[model samples]
Target chain A: MRLVTTNLTFAEVQPKLREVVDTLFKTVPAGVGSKGFLKISVPQFKQVMEEGVKWAVDNGYGWEDDLKNTEGYGKIEWADASKVSDKAITRGINQLGTLGSGNHYLEVQVAHAANIFDEKYAKACGITTPEQVVIMVHCGSRGFGHQVGTDYLKIFEDAMRRYGISVPDRELSCAPFSSREGQDYYKAMACAANMAFTNRQVIMHRIREAFSKVFQRSAEELEMNLVYDVAHNIAKVEKYKIDGSWKEVVVHRKGSTRAFGPGNHELSSRYQEIGQPVIIGGSMETGSYLLVGTKKAEEETFGSTAHGSGRTMSRAQAKREVRGEQLQKAMESKGIYVKAVSMPGLAEEAGLAYKDIDEVIDTLDRAGISKKVVALKPVGNVKG
Target chain B: MKQKYKFFDDIATADAAFEAYGKDLPELFTNAALATFSVMADLKKVAPKAKKKIVLKNPKAEGLLFDFIQELIYLKDAEYMLFSKFTVKVADGKLTATAFGEHINPEKHQLLTDVKAMTLHMYSVQQTKSGWKAFIILDT
Candidate 1:
């Protein structure tokens, strides 16, 4: 990815695009106890890190050669098994392909549609469907990531007092990349990241299988391509030009995305022409977007963009605001079919609970971190 | 004792409850857990037709609380069941409990947006002068 040259000039991101408006809702997982596919063991779970999409491919989940375009071939750098904690192992054992509840989603989105501004860019990123059934999975390392973060947050806080690293917030705590603790944390984090990539890949495979059964088409005929996969809660050690010099900085982007534009060395050489495809998932009711990283994004937001419409209300609040049954009726009126355990989850996740997604994307566009290529309006969703 | 839930002006947090009754931590936790569920579906219509025991490992105070909510949500999502009475105990800080719930009558359970995941953001638990208070972020 040599993005020293980005051809995205008239390429300002459209932020919140709405062309398909319905078909996107037809895909993905939602809600509590969302299916994790088959029961997997802790040992095979370790294989998840070692193989990434390879495990998925081996299990008839995805393509082994898909690694060519994946970031680090979908495996995080040096994900040693020893780094993951026992509790993380317990949580990961059963949650291999499960889409964790709340905000994390498996959505059916129409990635790109119409001439909506950047047609050339959309075509380059393989957004072929004027109304395409693109399956998008939003998940992470599950309990593994949460436990690693929780376990290490304690370590970092204790070390902070030892090292005297001044920080404004305790949550922003960090140890240098060179230290023993930092290295362990990095390894553990990498394991989680790889697990997440593997998790999504597995879910993608399950989705393809389900779609195959539903549409009566082979996986190849369905063309469930892996457009791009990015981690939201992640940190990367990448070279960013700061103060007119390439600085190897550890970029910590929590609740933000990596919006890398054209000619970046980190990207696969094949994608250099269009820029990195960035996935921004909106609420079930709101829909999602596909944006490309901009050079301006590198300059601003630490090469980041907002992860999703930041929640403005709690599930509790949404529950209070709308009854689950009535909300379902409302969504049905809008032509979106939702299946959930309770109305509270539906109301809480109601598109209105968060900041206006289009506004958030517009903010990112104005900030110049990323620009929209395709807008997907969800028509169907599966709540766990 | 009745404790009211008030939403602190939070961006990611939607519902919150703070209640304290008696000095019993278990009772306090029971109240907090019930408070969160009450916001979703009415427990009045729910009957204790079946009882199930659950165990979660490495359960610190916070992890136990998190797993507790997740377990209930899982039962609801997977089994179409919702619990009313939670007889929970934190022995040596590990979770051991018997919960009472029944299949969610499709006609009764209010279906909200399924909570996708619980977030570490703005999560906290503390013993208040009255009893206990906890804040959690539910990914929607």
Candidate 2:
């Protein structure tokens, strides 16, 4: 998500945004063999799994207040480091503060005044003008999360037979929620969730550094505070009304965001009166959005909302439809500076490959799942 | 002979899916490994300059094959290597394979995307009229 600042116009920072994108692109490439900004030992990696965003801030990667703005205060409780496998720890050891490939990006955007729906909410988020600049960092737990999922799939598959459970598809392998295998997987997943939070926190720190270097101003001067961060892919145990009775259930929101309404205790006090901030990331060429959870969302849909514009075409088809160079030029023509490691990778994420973000958000708004707070137009992007 | 492996774009809604064919289980698994790497980088450019030995065991053939491909993905992220050639041997629900590739050279190998892990969604390994076949999906 982007940091809100005053009087930062697209024209003034266009050059700087381009430079930042170029630097980030060169610094973080896609796929294997790419180097990360931070290097940590095995012990430090364990700390990341245990502490999440708090670990990043303690390591001087971010401010302490940044945790307050993050979901779950930047750390999920019950994340047992012992649950994480040695392979997962090894994969995460060196990949901290790095942005991985395929649709993961860091973009510089402006909140257009005309698109601001709720002035008070926008101001509360520190955005007071159309010229206000924010940097959206999109990444996750990297290979650490991947390894955790891979490890659990095998474990769950094996446990299914022991528990006399069978599914039509192997992907649906499972164990009883209260079973040992289930609890262990949950703990391991929480570790990955923390890894993702820390991953974004570290990347935000790097973004701040890049801005500081380019503008010759401190992050504090820029008011580069995190507005809010939400985890889209994960499961959480929460109490929700089911059949007129409150029931404790696990909500698995894959490609969705938790949009708890106003007065929800889980939200930070600053945003408790309004709602949890939800960041919706779009393609490199298309713009993004900032929304707030609603009471209706709580009553319906399990307080969930769409995470992004969503893909309309397959990657292979996207690559076949548009050449990367052509897509890059098209994005440039639209005044969006793009820095990428591979042309094919760039082409695979062409804006046309996704649904219109405005339409998707409109649907959410109409459904009362979430209400739009501000619209952010991308000016610069670094793709992996 | 029919092609050893080929990718199907729509087989998965959000992943890369492929079908590997072989006259035997070993050849089927070998082609599956090749298909997996091909999704990560251009296999032709991945030189056979480095060799890594992978051993995996499972009570089921499908599970063994899944683990075999997952090991390759692990090596890609852990060792930063990309393999284009493989000599796989499967016996008694165990896999022993010698994977040949080199360290990822960004200049030489144009990476398409990172293959994070193999997904069991619609995963299958079966004997066919021709020989054996495996269907696999990779989470990117």
Candidate 3:
């Protein structure tokens, strides 16, 4: 997930909601089999797997400061392009800068002054003004990441047999971390991770350009700064005090985010005092939250917190309960304009389909895992 | 009652789960392909403007079913095509399929979820007293 705050406010953007969303929808491809504007080849895409957002910045798609605000500087050092499969490359090569479907989206939100829970942290993260309009995007490595997982699941299933391992379920198929297959999977996963970082960076570039066009101001003049970029599902090797001694272990964060507290060396210097930023994306109809990591989280939960206000209803049930047209009309009545590729897809992402965002954020804040900084309510969205 | 497939309401929360039925392997494979693509596009509206031949082999019937559906997904991403019609033949551990579809034009097709990968979670292919059945959970 990523959030980019701008100098513009809700009042300034309210009238141009449809035009802004349409411009964004056109700039960034969404929906099934969405292809990007970049026409790079397999070999060029290999460089993307290795370099991450650095490739985007070097290719004139992003600002240099974006590197410092992004997790891992937008690249995974262990990424090895050779470890990635040809099929994975083929799927991901044409998928850069896409928002993708099934709950993934790019929303224009307003950070209400009253919603600021921690004024210090909110200001520190570049969210200062009342009703500040910001862009929040929820996406990931796309098909490339899925294909890597799929390839390894098949490989690990066979490797488990060779290793004489038994698991309760097929999804638990595994190989020792030191094994060749495990190392291969990790390297391949890193490649996908890098590609994902680049994917968001490319999308960010298009977002800046679109805002510039719609608002008739340069992205820099508009102060369209990326607040932070984080990965929801990723595994990283980190050091922790285990049994009184610091040890390095692989921490897998599935459906979770890394909430590294203040003073952690991993965080960028700009956030050294505040802590790592955490973006919890709720359903499009509701809103999302900006948070800062807590020391308690680092000590108790391995610096981890919930990724989002998870679904309360399944897609099939959501579609049955709500009509897409009705939901769209209802949202418009409430001042949230939305553009979707498919109606049924829109119905599946109804706000009622998800748990309450306030309750979820309150739970996290009360647990001392992450401190709420600001609450951003959506004004417009481009759904994939 | 006879049906090609039915989506489950509770099996998978973040993904789509379904069961495809057929009287035999060929029909089962074809129905599975249709079920998979239906998650991506409105099959009735996706015109068959192009065609592709797929050949795959796996010793396990379950693995064969996995590969067959996976191939269609592969094409969806690699070729930007959505297949609505399919024909399949399985013999001597080899499966051959002919799929028909067209380039994804948003104006013509109502594109839905982007089915990324097929998961082995609750995945099964079996022969029943009445027909062949397979349960699949697709990652979106």
Where is model 3 chain A poorest over a 10-residue stretch in terms of lDDT?
A168-177
Candidate 1 at residue A70, lDDT?
Answer: 61
RMSD of each candidate? 6.6, 1.5, 1.0
lDDT (Cα, tens digit) per residue for candidate 2, span A151-187? 9888998799899999998888788989999999999
Best-fitting candidate, scored by DockQ: 3
Docking class of 2: medium
Candidate 2 local Cα displacement, residue A266, angstroms: 0.8
Cα deviation of B131, candidate 3, in Å: 2.6
Give a tens-digit lDDT track for model 3, residues A256-352: 9999999999888999999999999999999999999989998888889999999989998999999999999999999999999888999999999
Ranking by lDDT: 3, 2, 1
The lDDT, on a scale of 0 to 1, for candidate 1 is 0.64
Q: List the candidate 1 regions with Cα displacement exceeding 4 Å.
A: A1-30, A111-115, A164-177, B4-11, B14-26, B33-140
Per-prediction DockQ comes to 0.31, 0.71, 0.80
Best prediction by lDDT:
3
Candidate 2: segments with Cα more than 4 A from true spot: A1-7
| Segments in model 3 whose C-alpha atoms lie over 4 Å from true places | none
**Displacement of the residue A137 alpha carbon in candidate 1, Å:** 2.3
For all candidates in order, the CA lDDT equals 0.64, 0.85, 0.92
